[model samples]
Structure formats: structure tokens, C-alpha cells
Target: MLDIMAIISDGIGGGLKSVLNIAIIVFPLMIIMEIAKDLNILDKISDFCKPLTKWMGVSKESAFPLTIGLVFGLAYGAGIIIQSAKEGNLDKRSLILVSIFLVCCHAVIEDTLIFVAVGANGFFLLTIRLLTALVLTILISKKLPSLDKEK
Candidate 1:
């Protein structure tokens, strides 16, 4: 029937619109991230995260990816994390800790802003996410066996 065909068409069109909307946001964010990396802005942000990395007992190499994940989200940060791992900058323990922390609180700024737009309390949401990530990372770090022995 014509109604069935119309429904199918509408579904496909709606799906494409959703994908396009996400691409619009993601593409610009990725470009900006590349620009920041080239300009060494990412290094400065990583430096700022050193204390947090130390508190979590992960290596200094994890700071950059951790910062990226917090600011940009895991989808973007995963590239940096993978590169660092391939370069031997991150050990197993560091990778696990970074993954744990990021999983808990990736994309704080973007997520908070989106929620705030929908009438959610941004500060409270940000605080809870950050705290949860910190506490969970630290606790998990303590539980993971030392990588030194794996060698």
C-alpha cells in the first residue's frame, strides 16, 4: 500500500536527518581537536591534569588522553589513547585506569551543556560526574596489580 511506502520513506529520512545532525557536531569538534593538538594547546591541558593523573597513579602519558576524554568525549579521546598505547607510552595499568576514568566521566562540558539546555542542573551534574570518575579511578587503580611485575 501507499501508506506502507510512505512510512518507510519517512523512517529513512528521519534516520538520515539524525545522522546528519550528529555528523555536524562531530566533524567540527574533530577539526578543532586536531587544531588544538597542532598548536600545543593539548599539551597545556595535559600539564594541568598532571596532579589528577598522579593522584590516580597513572603515568604522565595518560594525562593527555584523559584530558581529551573529559573535554571532548571518548570517541575523540580513543584515538589519542590508542596512539599512546602503540607508542609504548601507556602501560597496561595506565590504560586500564584511563579507560575506567573516562568511561565514568567523558565529555563533561558537552554533556553538561546539553543537559543544562534541557533544564538540568549543570554544576551538580558536572560535580557528580567528576567526583565519581575520580573516586572510581583511584579505587580501581589501587585494586589493579602493579604492571612492574608483568615484565
Candidate 2:
């Protein structure tokens, strides 16, 4: 028979561990994002990414969130994308493009690190993810207008 006290202890321990892990990752990332914003470095980075975004039919405004999703992860980047959408910065086409890309390959850095720790080929995985997302986003961008008309 299972011990009730032991199960309770394990549950609480798991919850605390999860909370700590999230805090460790999120707090430092938030600080870095804030510093980048304060120095206008994010704008510069987004400017450099404009050509790639344009190729995927994504807006310049969406580049910031896309870059964030690429580096940090979807959870952190999503807030920026949602706020921009609410502010009328991203049209349906741009939103669709960004969604396709991020869904395929968000959290490149963190995911690579985690995979590498487990002996996976992080660089190879990262490259594959990026290429796949790029190709798929390009295809989606090309097809989106026709799809929209059908809807």
C-alpha cells in the first residue's frame, strides 16, 4: 500500500522544484530583456532581422517577438506579439507568419542547451529547426492569401 504522507510530500516537492526552475530561467531573462530595451538594442537587433521577417511576410514589428521567441521561448515572446496585435501593429498575414515560425522553432537557445546537456547534437538540431521553420513559413506566407480568400 502507498503511504499518503509520502505521496503528499512528493507532490509538494515536485511543485516547489518546478517553481524554482521557472523562476531561475525567467528572472534572468526578464532582466536581460529589460536592459536590451532600455539601451534600444532590441530595435537594432530587430532592424537586422527585418529582411528575414520580410521574406516570410512578417511585419517589422513582429520581428521583435519572433527574435524573442527564437532566443528565449514562446511563453516570454507571446506577450509581446499579443500586445502588438492588440495595438493593431500586426495584420492577419503577419500574425499567421509569426505563428507558423514560432510554433516550429521557439526557444532555440534554451532548448539547445537542454538537449546538449542530454548528449544531443544541439547545433544540428538548431539548424534543422531553423531551416524547417523558415521553409514552412515561406510556404505559408505564399499560400495565405489564397487560403484567406477561400475562408
Candidate 3:
């Protein structure tokens, strides 16, 4: 009985710790994103990413969220993506493309470092992920019917 109670307690404690850690990271990122939006930093980022987004057939508004997802992982990026969608910055097609791309390649730096620590080839891993994401997003974007046409 005592052992079971300890196990339950440990599980709950670990879950709370994980949640707290994520909250710590996500909250600050959300605030910084808001400040960046107010400063028009997002516009510059979108402009810089214009070529890539254009190639992906997504709106420029997707650039920031896609960049965030690739660098910081999806959990952190989802906040920005959701906010952009709510603001009407991303249409359905853009959202779908960004989600597809990030699903394949999110957290490139962190994941690559972790794999490298485990004796994996970091360059190969990063390259394959990036290439797969890019190709897949481009192909899927071409297939998807434009939401604008439905409206």
C-alpha cells in the first residue's frame, strides 16, 4: 500500500514538474512574441522568409510560426501559430501547410543535438528532416484545393 502510494505521488510530481517546465518556457515566448508583433519585427521576418513561404505556397504570415516551430519545437510554436490564425493572418491553406511542415521538421536544432549526443549523424539527420519537410510541404500544397475557391 505504501509503495503504491509512493509511486502515485512520484508520477504526479513528475507530471507537474514537466508541465511547469513547459509553462516557464512557453509563457515567456508568448510575451516576447506579442512584443515582437507590436514592434513589427514579425513583418521583417515575414519579408525575409517571403521566398521560402512563396515556394511552400503559404502566406508570409506562416513564416514566423514555421521558424519558431523549427527552432523551438511545436509546443512553443503552436502559441504563435494559433495567435496568427486567430488574427486572420493565416488562412486555412497556410495553416495546413505550416502544420504539415512543422510536423515533419520541428525542433531541428534541439533534436539534432540530442541525436548527436547519442552517436547519430547530426548533419544527416538535420538535412534529411529539412529536405523531407520541404518536399512534402511543396507536394501537398500543390494538391490541396484553395480555400479561397470554396468561399
Clashes of each: 0, 0, 0
What is the C-alpha lDDT profile of model 3 across 1-151, one tens digit per residue? 9999999999999889766765665677667767876898756765676777898999877888987787668997788889998998989999989998998888776677656654689889999998889999999999998987799
TM-score of each: 0.74, 0.70, 0.69
Using TM-score as the yardstick, the better of models 2 and 3 is 2
Question: What is every candidate's alpha-carbon RMSD to the true fold?
Answer: 4.2, 4.8, 6.4
lDDT of 1 by residue, 31-54 (tens): 887788699897898889999999
Stretch of 10 with least lDDT, candidate 3: 109-118
User: CA lDDT of 2 in candidate 2?
Assistant: 70
Quality of model 1 by C-alpha lDDT: 0.86
Ranking by TM-score: 1, 2, 3
lDDT of 2 by residue, 1-114 (tens): 379988999999988976676667667766886787689886787777788898897767888888878766888678878888899897777877897799888978667755
Residue pairs clashing, model 2: none
* Model 1 misplacement above 4 A: 1-39
Residue 54 displacement (Å), model 3: 1.2
